[model samples]
Target: MTNIGGAFRRNINRIGADNLSLILALVILVFLITVVSGWAGYDGGDKFFSWQNLMNSVAQAIVIVGLLAIGETVVIVAGGLDISVGSVASIGSVVAASVLVGVGTFGSTLLPTGNVVVAVLAGIIAGMVAGAINGFIVTVLRVNPIIATLGTLAAFAGIAFLLAPDGKPIGVVTQPDFTWLARHRLFTDVGIPDLNGSAWTGIPVLTVIFVIVTIIIHILMAYTDFGRAIYAIGGNEVAARLAGISLTRIRIGMYMISGGVAGLAGVLLTARTTSGNPINGVGLELQAITAVFLGGAATTGGKGTIIGTFLAVILVGVLNNGMNLLGFNTFVQRVALGLLLIGAVAISQWRQVREEKVRARALALQS
Candidate 1:
């Protein structure tokens, strides 16, 4: 019994007590919203609660900021930041689309393995190359992450614009399977009844992709040495460097990861919209920042989680969908979102302070 009790305690320790309250708060909020909305005759079926609407919401949330959050989580945890994620996303899609169109009607038998593979690879390569440039500019020029990424943000955006010379979408990308990835339902084969007399059944394919990608990323960040290094670097760059960690390589890796993921998001967005424009991801950086911050990553660095990000993403989705359903104007919605973000941050800071105080008191008593 003692052994079993100790084992249970150890498991509890691994989970950490800090985030339990956040989870509780999330549950309470969700419950309160559901009950209140139901009482008020909300019928969020068309608003945010429907499978289609929820999937659409999740897709929009993930595709625009998902990659950026994954990348920023690494970058910020590594004690750096990049403002060029949006640009990378824009460039990535443009490159992929350009490659697809350039492949012509013999798309399936192209120089590469297949058109799908080529398109994905094109985006990945464009993003990685752009990331490398950002890293070089940061490490070589010794520029601040903000400034360096800002300059590259403009330059990369320009290059993406150039690649999209016609300023119009290209390719026969409307193929059902390809289009279904971002715009179609997941269980049409399962035969779910459709509301609104519309044929949009079950879950959106984008939501499934987001879930799969998020799970993979969650594992990667939690179970790898590279992931640990990212957190250490962000927590204390000087200490991390003094500990014999490779500051240059890790720094570069963070940016590259950021760029690569942003590129991935671009592809998903393009698939959803059937467009591959240079200006596609405009203001996306802001949304990504919002997601990162909302996900519980400290603006000052050294704290984050995949779960936190998931909750935050869903929170934003809920807020957006709810407000739209409530018929709130754009200005009001923005104001509410801003206030919500600020409040969450303030709560985090307050909790951090309280925990520090508790630790200090315990130490003092022990002494």
Candidate 2:
């Protein structure tokens, strides 16, 4: 009992009070939302906790946000930020959809069907190229990350709009094969029946993809040397550089990964909507950053967990779902999200200050 208690204490110490408080808050919020949802019901149907709704929440609302959040987490942990992920995603969607359908905005066929794979590759490459540009601007030109990415944000979005002028949506909406990327299910009508004849269907393919991505990222962040270097650089760039860590290479690579993932997210968005809307990814960057920070990652960087991010995304999804069920307007929802982002950053900074004070006192006592 003593050993187990000691281990528990050590784990808490490792996580720190801020993260512990955040976790508790998440649990409480989830509990309250679930209880209220059950009590209030949804759209006159007593189905707040239904599996169908859960699946929809994960598949439609959460997956893309989660992916973007994961990429943002990487950059944030590496002591940088990319505010242009949304714009990059938008460009990726426009390009990918245009290529996939082999048509330009004016409905002219630009590529053959045999080039579908190449088209997808082209879209991803476009995103990576944008990321590389951001990286070059920041590392080579020594521009601030926030400013560089912000500039790219506008540039990328403008490019997307230019490609699909007047808010046009590209791609064949009625093509089942193209739409299957988002609509396909891992299982259908294969159910586990109880003695009372109750049964459940299954999860969406997108949800599965999201889960796999999360797991892979969790491992990469937790177990890789590259991850450690990122954290080190975030914690203290000079110290990391002295330790032989290549800041330029690492930072550029981080941005590239961020852009690449955002591109893939754009593709997924196109799949889900069956149309590549140039404005599709607008405001997503804010949501992704909000999720990462809310997950207990510091704005100053060097500390965060993939699990925290995953939970944060789930929390956001639930909040959005709950708000929809409560009949709130989209404007109100946006306000709530903006406030949440500010609050998350405030809480994270406060925790860092508190930890610094504690460490100072400890050092003084030792002296």
Candidate 3:
């Protein structure tokens, strides 16, 4: 019994108290939503729990923001923040659409398939360039990350509108191959039927992409020297410098990764909407930032996990879906998200203070 108790304690410690709390919170929220849904008679007398909703609707809806959150996690872990990702994604959307349509200098030179390839590459490169610019401003120009990204946010949004035809959305509905990323599903025939008797559409490609990206990021952060360096830099810049970590290189790389992921999200946005709207991805940066902090990431940096952020993404998605199902308006949803962000930040600060007090007590005892 003693050995079993010791093992359980060790496992709990390994998982972290905050993460366990987050899990509990998630479970409670689901239960409450389910109960409310039952009482309100939403979804035609069915409760909120359903395979279709989880596998299809919620998963698909969260992909874009989820991708952004993954990138934000890396940046935050490196003691940096990026507020320009939404604008960067918009730029990517317009750039990809323009290339696909052979607008301007693209000149209809490539075949349809070639255009698709080029457009995807162009969008991703545009995002990387934007990220590189942010990094340069922060590292070489010595500007603060927040201020630098905020400047680029407005600038990039302008650039996105300019890149579009007459500052309007460009239609790509004619491109069947390009829209596959948004419309197609894997194993369309395999999933369980919904209450409406319609067979599930299988897993969304966008969701699959999000999952793959998350897994890769988790691996990178959990099992690599580069990831350790990022944490060290965030934890203590002076100590990291003494240990020979290249803060500039790591910071820039992180920004680039963030931008690249945003670009991919933009590509999917274009596919999902069947157009390249210059206004696409507006306000998404806030949600991504919210998920990062809500996932138990330290506001002062040096502590976070991809898994935590992913779960937070699911929580946010479910909350939004439930509100929509309950006929709540966008304004109310926004208010709820704002409150959640405040609560998450407050908890983080409280934890930090408590840890400090515990450390002080330990030092005194040692003395």
Candidate 4:
């Protein structure tokens, strides 16, 4: 028992207390959701716990938010914030759809695949440009991150509406190739006997993309000098500058990355809805920011993990899915998420205080 206890402590220290807490909360929430689902007559919780739902429903549903969270993680880690990502996504979707409809028509007679590539490029580029503008305002113009992004949020959203005809959804149903990202699945013929002996359609392309992006971001943040610079800047801008880290360049790059990812999410959104609805990503920035904070990213910046953010995204997805199954209204769901955000921020502030106290005590002892 002593040995086991020691091993557990070691593991906890390695994984971090914040991450462990998130895991425990996720497990408890799952159990509660299952019990509630059973009581609600959802076939003993199968509605929320089934394999099909996990893979097809929940995984697919979280892709957009997950992507946004990943980008937000980078920005937050670099000592900045971007509340304009959703608006950037909206802009990307509109741009992608418009390009698809226009170029797709012309390319249909020539190179069929060319239009899809062009449309995707246009969307991503639009997002990156929007991000650059945000970075410029914050770094060059000396605007606060919150105010700068908030301004862009409104501006970009309006731009999206203006780009769309009559301020409405641009239908992309006719562009089947463009929507393939949302519809395609791998291994449709693989039968899993353990899963009701049915052929598993494998994972959705969108989910696969999300996983890939997560892995890439994780590597970028964990194993690169660029990532370390970001951490240094977030932890202490003055110290980092003295250490010769270019705050302006790194922060701008981080914002561009965020915008690029948000743009990709926008493209995926267009694929999923088969339309470029200017309002599609209206409130998604809130969810993404929530996930970043809830995943243990410091509100003051300088600390976070891609893995934690990914897990947090899953937790949010599960919570939303379970609530929907239980017939909770959207308004109630929004309130719950708002509460979660508040709790996450509070926890982050507490952690920061504790760390500061520990450091102070150590410095005093050394003196």
Query: Which of the numbered candidates is closest to the native, going by highest lDDT?
Result: 4
- On lDDT, the stronger of 2 and 3 is 3
Whole-model lDDT per candidate: 0.71, 0.80, 0.85, 0.88
Instruction: Say which candidate scores most in TM-score.
Output: 3
Instruction: Provide the lowest-lDDT 10-residue window in model 1.
Output: 104-113
Q: Model 3: which ten-residue window has the lowest total lDDT?
A: 104-113
Model 1 spans > 4 angstroms off: 1-22, 28-47, 59-61, 103-114, 171-177, 190-200, 355-367
Candidate 3 regions with alpha-carbon error over 4 angstroms: 37-47, 104-114, 191-198
**Model 1, TM vs. native:** 0.83
Which of candidates 1 and 4 is the stronger one according to lDDT? 4
Instruction: Please report, as a residue range, the 10-residue window in candidate 2 with the lowest summed lDDT.
Output: 192-201
Residue pairs with colliding backbones in model 1 are: 77-234, 78-234, 79-234
Point out the higher-scoring one by TM-score: 2 or 3.
3
lDDT of 1 by residue, 108-218 (tens): 333352366678677877898899899988987899998998898898888877677555555436544545557666566776666445445666666676677777777
Q: Per-residue CA lDDT of candidate 4, range 1-367, in tens?
A: 9999999999999898878888998998888788855775664345665657777778899999999999999999887899999999998898888788863322233223338888888788889999999999999999999999999999999998888777878789988898999999887667654454323557899999999999999998999989999999999999999999988898888899899999999999999999988998899999999999999999888999999999999989988987887778899999999999999899999999999999999999999
Candidate 3, after superposition: displacement of residue 74 in Å?
Answer: 0.9
Error of 4 at 337 (Å): 0.4
Off by over 4 Å in 4: 1-10, 36-44, 103-114, 194-199
RMSD to the true structure for each prediction, in A, is 4.2, 3.1, 2.4, 3.0
lDDT of 1 at 63: 51
